[model samples]
Target: MIMDLSKQVKIALDYIQSIDVSDIDDTSEAGRIFYEKFIPMAGEEETIYKIENLEVPSFEQTINIRIYRPSNEKELPVVIYFHGGWFNAGGLESHDRPLRKLANLSGAIIISVDYRLAPEYPFPTGLNDCYNALEWIILHAKMLGIDLKRLAIAGDSAGAALATVITRRAIQNNLNKILCQLLVYPVTDASLKTPSWQEFKDGPVLNYEGAVQAWNLYLPNIKEIENPDASPLYSDELSDMPSTLMIIAEYDPLRDEAILYAEKLQKSGVAVKQLLYKGMVHGFFQMGGIIDDGNRAIEETAQFLIQNFNK
Candidate 1:
């Protein structure tokens, strides 16, 4: 059944329709517009206890990372986050507001990793950057005032896909400090053939054609789409994945894949919690200023992280 769009979301979609985004994929035009327009109106930035910028050395390159300390508490848990842009557009600045809110709400030091984008740095580059950042954070936990034992990984959309893949890699490498994964409407499959993808093919925020474009831009070869590292849903084993909390939107093309991933995790013996927000569409989590559900999801996400941290 098709769900009606929330009133606020409908208004937001109208505003989006008014813009001339026909050239969104041209020279990162979509990113420019996102930073200039959408970001400023994303809502008030949360008051963080402290914020720090650092560069982590990773495979002959240095990846930028933003750390948000929520309080003066020592040995606090940490959440390493990756921003979503279908692995091409978003960065540290584009997602600053939501990360700050997450830091404050979760009361955990939030390390936002600015992984390299695709089309230029295609498949494996961004993923490797994220994994390297995770390793660096764990290695420098003591100096960063982070409790290695209570570490968590999180991201929205493409970033969530990275988080899941990172968790799996961590398990394989036996770097088992990760306690949980907080995925917000993640892109779990590169195939883009799910029922929700067809149902919401032209949905407000993300559409089927856009998703296909994203995958094509991120993966040089179509075969990469089935690679587990590129698509978490294709992973052979998920039994040792970290405890998970996935937030799904009813009207999102990525909805079914996210739900299916949660079910797969549960069957693999991983503790899983899934929340389906009715009448919501993709990217709602980043629209706290315009959508009430964004803030509520943040609270719920924080609670979930806290519960896992305490365990």
Candidate 2:
């Protein structure tokens, strides 16, 4: 039986439900309004480091990147993060608290990337921005006072897809510097017929219709669905990718894809660790103030990154 959510989770879900659903019709207007109004709702407490906006390579646009630096001043690991919004929504501002907590918990520097949204820039554009961010982080590790060899990439939902794709591209280009990847309820495949999609078609937070709309924005066309850059599940290589830590919400629509990706990674001889939190729905990670389970998952993720990368 599914467990009832605690009061905090209930409140968080209430806020989540209050956010307007993205309409595929007016991509920019709906997306902008939803993010401007909704992103700030996720708490962002003042922290030790300064948040700065910077431009990255391979793109003409100036990306918003936040850096949370520890006061200890010692060299720490760097985690480059992307926020979930199905490619059409979400940005650096939306995922502030989660990223801050991750930095605080892991005792690492967290760099959150604000890549371009889709239906405007489309595939490879957002993906490339994230890749450039990775490259920028690696190149400027010294200035950031982070250990370049300990660099990792992480994200939730669609951002998670970007994270995985960046890791694969890093491997293909022989950028051999990435140490790990953290994926939370990631959209691993663009083929919308998975059993999880059927079972959790109307599940809370992220539903089938919302997911399809998001995919349409990211993919922009049918032909791109099979491209590995847009869908990492179709990628021919996984053996050379970094070690992976994937978190899946049992009730999420994307659970099966998360599971299948883990299996494929393991089969391909890549080290993969998966955690399935039962009775949880998609976007639980962002509800830390409401869900005890959300806090627990974040803590587990922090520990996972610190423990593995500390090796």
Candidate 3:
């Protein structure tokens, strides 16, 4: 058995190592291949509310949204989620377990959005779909029994980047419906100059090269890659963003980016809290049962959401 760490942390690290490491380095076609194989290994859990996929009328695209509601009849706050796959992979199937746990832990309605992937739909497509889904949820809030004033946006990895962008777009558009953001190791910068990138150049799960590959697929163009909407770290206006809780891994490549974003948010007068889990790597929160840190991260996030939301 793996030792030299806490019981939970060991399990999490083992889970990370147990994943097939062969194709992980191949960023071209192998990235997709790894994800196709990785999702099934993620495991599952039963959710409290029924899930349904819906399409966006504006884009004429079929966007998958999994809605989780409590057993009570009252309208709860809505948490819109985007799953992580470096913007190229991950969907409803890969993230179902964590969303379910989040919904139950926070006692809120969870709406998980399967935004369009990269290299095909690219940049604005996925970001716009997420924002559009938020709009749809607000327009039909009454139907979904949702509290418009208490809505929040959340995501991991590339999804987290999308969440921050959506929050910025919402704020800029005068949509004051967002209450807070739960960002789990978000990729804020695309310049790849951050120290975290160099330190975790060979880190597990989300390696340094994988980061570049994902960005290449999403942006595909040199100019568009540096756009603030595509890379939140490039944005000049961090003000007007809602209260945020950013969870970072001590040993992950995106750690500095997440920290820098938190610093920017704080400088902008946005209430922000940063939680750093030591000796942890990327992709810990979503890998339930396999990692103790995953469970701990989920509980901490749920508590944070319950406290700041609707206040």
> What shift in Å separates residue 48 of candidate 1 from its native position after superposition?
1.0
lDDT of 2: 0.81
Which candidate model has the greater TM-score, 1 or 2? 1
Q: What is the alpha-carbon lDDT of model 1 when measured against the actual structure?
A: 0.87
Candidates sorted by TM-score, best first: 1, 2, 3
Which pairs clash inside model 2?
Answer: 8-290, 9-290
Identify the runs in model 2 with alpha carbons over 4 angstroms from their true place.
1-9, 20-27, 35-46
Using lDDT, give the best candidate's number: 1
CA shift of 216, model 3, Å: 0.9
Which prediction has more favorable TM-score, 1 or 3? 1
Cα-based lDDT at residue 204, candidate 1? 66
TM, every model: 0.95, 0.91, 0.90
Local distance difference test values of all predictions, in order: 0.87, 0.81, 0.80
| Model 3, span 1-311: residue lDDT tens | 12135565565556556756474575545556655544433456765756666665548756778787755657788889988888888888778777788888998888988888888878888888888888888888898888877888999988999999998898889876688999999988888888878776877566777777778888888898669998898888887888899999887888898999899899989999999988777887776656667778888989988997746
C-alpha lDDT (0 to 100) for residue 282 of candidate 3: 81
